[model samples]
Target: MTNMLLAVVVGLTAGAALRPAVVALAIPAGRPADCPACSPRPAGPTVLRLLSSGCENCRGQLLDAPWWLPPAATAAAFAAVAAGDATGWYAAAQYWIAFLGTALLLVDSAVQRLPDALTAPAAVGTLVLLAGAAAEGEPGSLPRAVAVAVAAGVLFTAFALGSMGLGDAKLAVSLGALLGWRSWQAAWAGLVLAFTLGALFAVFLLLVQRRSRKSTLALGPALIIGTLAVLATGP
Candidate 1:
């Protein structure tokens, strides 16, 4: 219970801190990347601002983030702590994914695009943390993790030729490594669940008349959700 509470607090804090970056990066392509809220400001004040009423400069100019990010991030962290490996390193890896995955989901849902700024760092951070886990007596094969990541990237690249984007492909690399660290079956399950959830989401959107058959849906959130679900439920 204590650990869970700690995880929730950490998630809330981190998620709040991430709001500025989310507003900054969720812009449409070809637009200026500057965040009116935190641009030219140091990290300390930016984070502090998030804890308060947000930035004053970009009142309505920036993306209005959903109000549920902190709760969502808290859920992610709790899930990681509850279901992740006993070794602190593996739990840390899960927390990293949960944190960044929540941000990616929000950004993609809003803009229908995933920025390289988030995806690239997520990929690197997951890999590095997994390496730390391997060194600390975790029961996963780093080589297998790398191989699965490569294969997932290749496979998703093919999917990108269709409704998916290169951003999804890049995000897959990190998710694949995380799942593959468990087992091949977990990796396969995550992929299958992602597509299934995505299809279900599309159907829901259509039923509500929010999107048409030809409309491009954002799949990043589904992918992130599916990966997190598998991680939470997997042994």
Candidate 2:
């Protein structure tokens, strides 16, 4: 119970700390082409303020963030505990995974782009952490994770060729690694759920917002949410 509390605390801290990065990713580069007279805001200062919670320049802008941001971190802490991983290292890894996942989800939702910086590190780091977990008496799962990563990457690559962005495909690799670390079933379900949710959301936008079938939409949040759901509902 104490460990779970600690995990929640850590998750919340990391989430808060990384909020700036998410905000930075969401902000557009330079001034709008039509508003050349407006001074361009560098992402660095905004990031610093967002992290410190003190930048007047960024405080108002931060209001654009979804209300779920803080709760998602707390939920990830509960998920880490629910995974039945009692070790400190696993707990720490869980916190980081959830933190990074939330960041990716928020950034992608805002900008329709997932930065490689977050996705790449998340992929490599998750694999490493799961590898360590497997080393500590768990076995056969790491190979499954790698295999699922490859398979998910291939499937998403196909989507990227047509409907989805390559960044979303890359995001799949990380989510797949995490889900596949648990079981092949988890990996399969996560992938299915992600696309299902994304498709449903696209349909919703089309129906309600009058968006076209070819309208741009961010899919990363759905993918992240689905993966997190599967993680929380452990095998």
Candidate 3:
């Protein structure tokens, strides 16, 4: 119990430090709505904005932040720490992945965009970390992770060609790798849960907010949320 708490606290602190990095990576060139030219904005100011309890785009417009933001981040950290592998190094890797995923969720929710800078690196890094862990413990899980990631990416690519954003497809690579490392069930659950949650939100928007199908909300965050929820449950 003590170790779990300590790990959770460490994860939380690390996550706080990482929040800025998330913004930096997600928006290497910030998008300010006010700027018609959409000039490139430095990451430092954006990081400051995020730290100072502000999530303004490059245009200095305030973005909508869900009330669950902070608590969700903290919970993600805790869950990563609690449900990660017994190996210390593997657990630490999982914690950082969760932290990064949290940032992606926030940025995607706010801007309806997911930068390739963040998603690509996250996918590569997760695979490397999981591969290393598999060499020590579950060897077969490594191949499974790769297969699932590729399949999921392809699946989401098809979805992207129609309704979803391409970034979400890229993100599926990382999410699929992590969740599928455990089992096919976990991978399927994450994907199903994401669409289910997204559909529910769409309904809410249609009814309460009166948003139309044309004004599609960011689905990456919901997908991330579902994968993280499954990750938190452990196998």
Candidate 4:
């Protein structure tokens, strides 16, 4: 009970910290410099400014991020902590995905693009944290994790030629590494679940006339959700 409450606090605080970055990065590519919604340089402490809403110059709400993000993040963190036996750096890796995946889900849903800025760092950090886990006596093979990540990236790259984006492939590398650290079956399950969820979502949109057959769906959120779901369900 105490640990779950702590997870809630940590997730909320981290989600709040992530808001400014999400607002800044959620813009379409090649527009950050001239984007009207991008907040100006903060005169006060950047952290305080970020935690506050609205652009300082125009007093406009930037990105209009939904109110549920922090609560969703808290739930995700609680789920991750409750779902697995991960400890040490392994546990850190779980929390990393829980928080950062929420950010990615928001950005991708808003802009239909996953910034390399976030994806690249996330992949590297997952790997580094997994390495730390290995060093801390976690019974996982780092080489297997790398191999699974590469394989997942390659598979997703193939899918990118048609239904997905290169960004999704990059995100896969990180998720694959995290899942593979647990077990090969977990990694495979995550991949399958991602595609299945994406397809179901597209169908729902079609049924509701929210999207057309020719419309492109953002796959990042599905992928992130699927990976996190696998982690939250146990290996």
Query: RMSD in angstroms, all models?
Result: 4.4, 3.8, 4.9, 3.6
User: In model 1, where do residues sit more than 4 Å from their true spots?
Assistant: 30-58, 68-71, 74-81
Better of 3 and 4 by TM-score: 4
lDDT of each: 0.78, 0.70, 0.70, 0.79
Which residue pairs show collisions in model 4?
A: none
User: What value does the lDDT take at residue 171 in candidate 4?
Assistant: 92
lDDT value, residue 189 of candidate 3: 96
In terms of TM-score, how similar is model 2 to the real structure?
A: 0.80
lDDT of 3 by residue, 53-163 (tens): 334444342434444454457555566547643454355446656766777777787677788867887898888888788867843387888899999999999999887
Error of 4 at 10 (Å): 0.6
Per-residue lDDT tens digits for candidate 4, residues 92-143, read: 8878877777778888888888888888988999999999988887877788
State each candidate's clash count. 0, 0, 2, 0
Off-target runs (Cα >4 Å) in candidate 3 are: 22-75, 80-90
Q: In model 3, which residue pairs have backbone atoms overlapping below 3 Å?
A: 32-58, 32-59
Record all residue pairs in model 1 with backbone atoms less than 3 Å apart, i.e. clashing.
none
- Candidate scoring better on TM-score of 1 and 4: 4
